[model samples]
Target: MNTTLFDRVSAVQADLLVTFVPSEGAFPESTAWVDGNADGQLSQLRESGVFKGGLAQTLLLPSITQDFAQPVLLVGIGKDAELSDMQARKVIAAVAAQIKSLPYASVALASRALVLKKRTQSEVTALIAQWLNEGFYNFLGFKQDDAEKATKVTDLLIEGDDEAALAIGTATANGSAFARQLGNLPGNVCTPNYLASKAQHFGEEYGIDVELLDETKMDELGMHCLLSVGRGSDQPSYLIVMHYRGGEEGEAPHVLLGKGITFDTGGISLKPGPKMDEMKYDMCGAASVFGTMKAICELKPKLNFTAVVAAAENMPSARATKPGDIVKTMSGKTVEVLNTDAEGRLVLCDALTYIERFKPKSVVDVATLTGACVVALGSVNSGMYANDDAVAESLKAASQISADKIWQMPLNEEYQQQLDSNFADIGNIGGPEAGSVTAACFLSRFTASYPWAHLDIAGVAWSGGAAKGATGRPVALLTRYLLDKAS
Candidate 1:
């Protein structure tokens, strides 16, 4: 959707004009242009209890005069002094939801009177645009009949002081939507090859350099640990590397490693039949990487970054890597595969070792590495484990700024003992206790060369029930960190 800014409601030529109406019918200064009978109509409605103007309450008043060609939407925003960014976003989201259901193709958000506590006008405007895009999102690509699909809101006018905020927010939201689409697709359709193609397209369109390593190249490069994870699947695995050089020459880039198990069937270690379909979302980490890439490409910040995705499919077959199988990673570290279900770490470890070639200033690997992460943090926050304190703190600050919650989990020596192997140098699966931490510990062995952080996004990667789709999390958080670094 195209988002533009207008100074006043009179200047908005859209089919609908949105105005925030506070409690007790306190008219916002932004909507003061609706004088005479139109203004009186709103006051009379509030007085007669036709509209209470309570928080989240909305009223649609038809325009009687030709001065404004659209209807006025009265959105309740509670109190002025108490208005917060969260509340403002919620209000805008609610408005956007209503607008989506309406017949109008164009809508304007008159945000001048919004008293956003502790937030600048630009920040508020940006957030509103972001939420509006999210609210208006629809995944109808697979719908058989296009006639049943609702008419999309194509033009969004955000009446605010700063225009750049709307642009930034829109770009971020678009990236997120792209990630969501990738996550929501069935695994059959969105394979590792599909992700590789997407990466190549992104690199070509955005001026980034792309390199794809097939199973043959991976074998030649000694990526046996990563290659082992996809041994069961007919679909060949790929190591996709994307380089975006926006900084000075020879600058060490920040590296992001994603565990891309396109369809995780647990191989020899089979998962329960129930909810197996949701395993298609196993590639959400890679999807988020793609999302962040889209965002940074749009922002074009002066920072070098590289994203690597170890794309594979975990399936059960005769060729599948069985329990007790041993594999050497690119780092030459041996690992005993006690369970095939614990494959994300296998791919990520090799990728982590592979990333050392880049000599990255810092590295953060994103993955849905364990169910224990879901048990520990639930769906509220991604579990974070870092080998370095500064990397952890940097990501935490970015999470705060992006409003993507993350809790730092312990990666102490105590957890490392659980990963000890009897036959090999290390075990793939730690014996159930502190499972999330041990998984991080497993990957930490390969990332010893650089400042590294692990984001276990198992819980917050996607929703379960009716709203089952990717959240495109941590992308916002990751993007914010790079933005801060670029600045």
Candidate 2:
């Protein structure tokens, strides 16, 4: 919405700077490759040298520098062959992130040509634009009025061949903005009803299809597990199902599920008070799916996919479901609620059960489901667990290419044992030992009929520092994987 940013990126020329494109496996030069200015000697920068870590093996820039009219920035590529399309997007994002911080009036980039058959410059640009915006994102929603406001990034430049770069630039800006919208909304505003409304608008705008099930509809269909979480709150729950049918008519749609806990009080087993406000973002897993569904419409992959979000708010009240309560999931399995805070698994159980009706070939669910994941992996990577080895490997391949980190965690029979209950088929909270792994195990019960995987995004969904909104869009990795797989 800031017009200054729009003017800056649009008015600037892409021919101002130089980019170093190194061969595969090249390290940055110890010093800046300063070109001698009009003085016919090394530029003043060399005499007064600067260290921006531009040429670092951050993979945002190519190894060599393209000498243009202004500054030269050296970007590193760990390997050349591995410099595929997804990596290209990652480099563009990193480059755009760095560019916003520099004092340059404009900059040019000579990164590698991203080679994908149907992927156009427009899509590439959209991706870079999205990444650039996200790279400099600041989450000031929770800041006190007396706190100093953080700086906003204004100047930005995208460089490449004129036609492709310009096209990519515009799309990136739009896609990033789309992503930001999902990440920025306060949890109350992005509730199940709110998300359903957004989905309808996104569907009409992009020519996709959205089917949202209201509380009454969910009750009619007997989605008790999902309904159970929202029973505590005055706000009703919803299952938002969106269809993106871009593949061949008969191709099975790859299904995606998101945990849509808009606000989590941990129910009777409340989350500790330290950073409880972040409960608003507990729905980020669902937000990512919703955002990715929107972006996929713009990207238009050659695959049919259904994204389903079980969105709701979890609050503790006299009517709230308490620990020791047992409820039957849509899958017809009963789960004993061991801890009220373990409600994400309850919501996801029903969503996973509903996917059986679709009978898709693969399923992946994302949720900010567990704090144990944060303790184990820290905030750097989302913990990935799977029922199928091949599916997990494919996702890992996608994660590496995207650089939005994910690491494999055990989801074995042993973990299932941890969720055992004497009075029910399964228990919501796994005993505290491998809490995250146990939560995955609990969800796995409903997903047992499908070759499914789970992403516990608890750690990756947000950053503790000043960045505004959700940390970054991790769904882009999954979207990229599905796109690559379909192509």
Candidate 3:
């Protein structure tokens, strides 16, 4: 969508004019002209309790004036003091949902109507654009009927002069949309090779350096633990790397590792048949990495960034690794494959070991690694595990800035005992209790070489049931973190 800025509401021209109304206050001065032009219609609605400006409340009215010949959408944002960043995001989401199916070609937002506490105009502008784009997103790639698709707003006009903020917001949203598209594809269409191809294409488009290590090269590097997970699938596993060097020469890059199990069927220890199709979203962690990289490429942060994806597929076949199998990782650590279902950590362990070669400034690995995370935090927050306090704090700050909820989970040495095995250095699965904590502890063993953090995104990666699609989460959080680092 095209975004333009106007200085005054009177000068704005669009198919729809959107303004936020507080629960108990006069309309914003910037929108005063709108009320005057409408001949007290807005006040009449408020006086009649038809539009009291409660949070997420909305009212639509016809336009009879020549100053703006479009319908006005009054969206309630509640009190200005209580308008937290997440609440503002929800308000914008509501607005997007209200107009998603409407045939409006253009929409104008009264910027001054959004007066979020502790947030600057630039931040508000960015938030508005980012959430609107995200809220408007729909994956219709496989849908054959055109009529079934909803009409989308083509142009967004904001009453402001923050083009840079608009750019950042738009880039972030585009990145998220890209991730959602990749994550929503069926498992058959989005294989490990497909992810590698996507990475190569991303590198070419963004002028970054891309490298792909096939199963042969990985085997040569002793990535047996990673390779063993993909032994059953015909699709080859890959260690895909992309480097973005926007900083000075020889700078230690911030590394991002992603677990890319394109389609996980639990291998020899197969999962239940119900909702098996949702396994297609197993690669969402890798998709978020791609999304973050895409945004970084667009924003061009003055810091080197490296993305590593361990791409594989897990299926039960004659060649699949069974329970009790042990494989040595690239780090020379042996892992007992007690449960094939816990495959995300298997690939990630090798990737974490491999990332130590970069001597990275910090490493953050993203993975849809556990259902225990979903059980613990539900769909509200991604589970975070970090070895370093500073890294954890930084992510916490980023989570606030991006309004992407995350709760830091414990990674105490106590959890390490659960991963112990008599036959190997460690075991892939740590029984049933605190499954998410044990998974993080497994990855932490390899991350000892660098300041590292792990994000278990199993809960927030995608929604099930009627809204069964990728949410493209944590891209906003990751991008904001990188942006802050660059600043």
RMSD of each: 1.9, 6.7, 1.6
The full ranking of all candidates by TM-score, starting with the best, is 3, 1, 2
The lDDT per prediction is 0.86, 0.68, 0.89
Give the candidate number with the greatest TM-score: 3
- State which candidate, 1 or 3, has the greater lDDT: 3
Off by over 4 Å in 1: 35-37, 64-69, 84-86, 146-151
lDDT of 3 by residue, 1-487 (tens): 8877788887777899888777777888765677788787777777788889888898877665675568888898776655777688779988988888677889998866786777788888888889888888888757687446755688988778898888888889988998999999999999999999998898779899999999989999999999999999999999999999999999999998888999999999999999999999999999999999999999898999999999999999999999999999999999999999999999999999999889998899999999999999999899999988988999999887777899999988888899989999999989999999999999999988889999999999999999899999879989988888788
- The order of the candidates by lDDT, greatest first, is 3, 1, 2
Candidate 2 has its poorest 10 consecutive residues by lDDT at 1-10
| Better candidate by TM-score, 1 or 3 | 3
| Candidate 2 C-alpha lDDT tens digits along 43-101 | 23223333222322332222123342444454443335334555665666566556555
lDDT of 1 by residue, 129-190 (tens): 77778777777677787445554677888887687777777878888888888888999999
Q: TM-score for each prediction?
A: 0.95, 0.78, 0.96
lDDT of 3 at 133: 81
TM-score of predicted model 1? 0.95
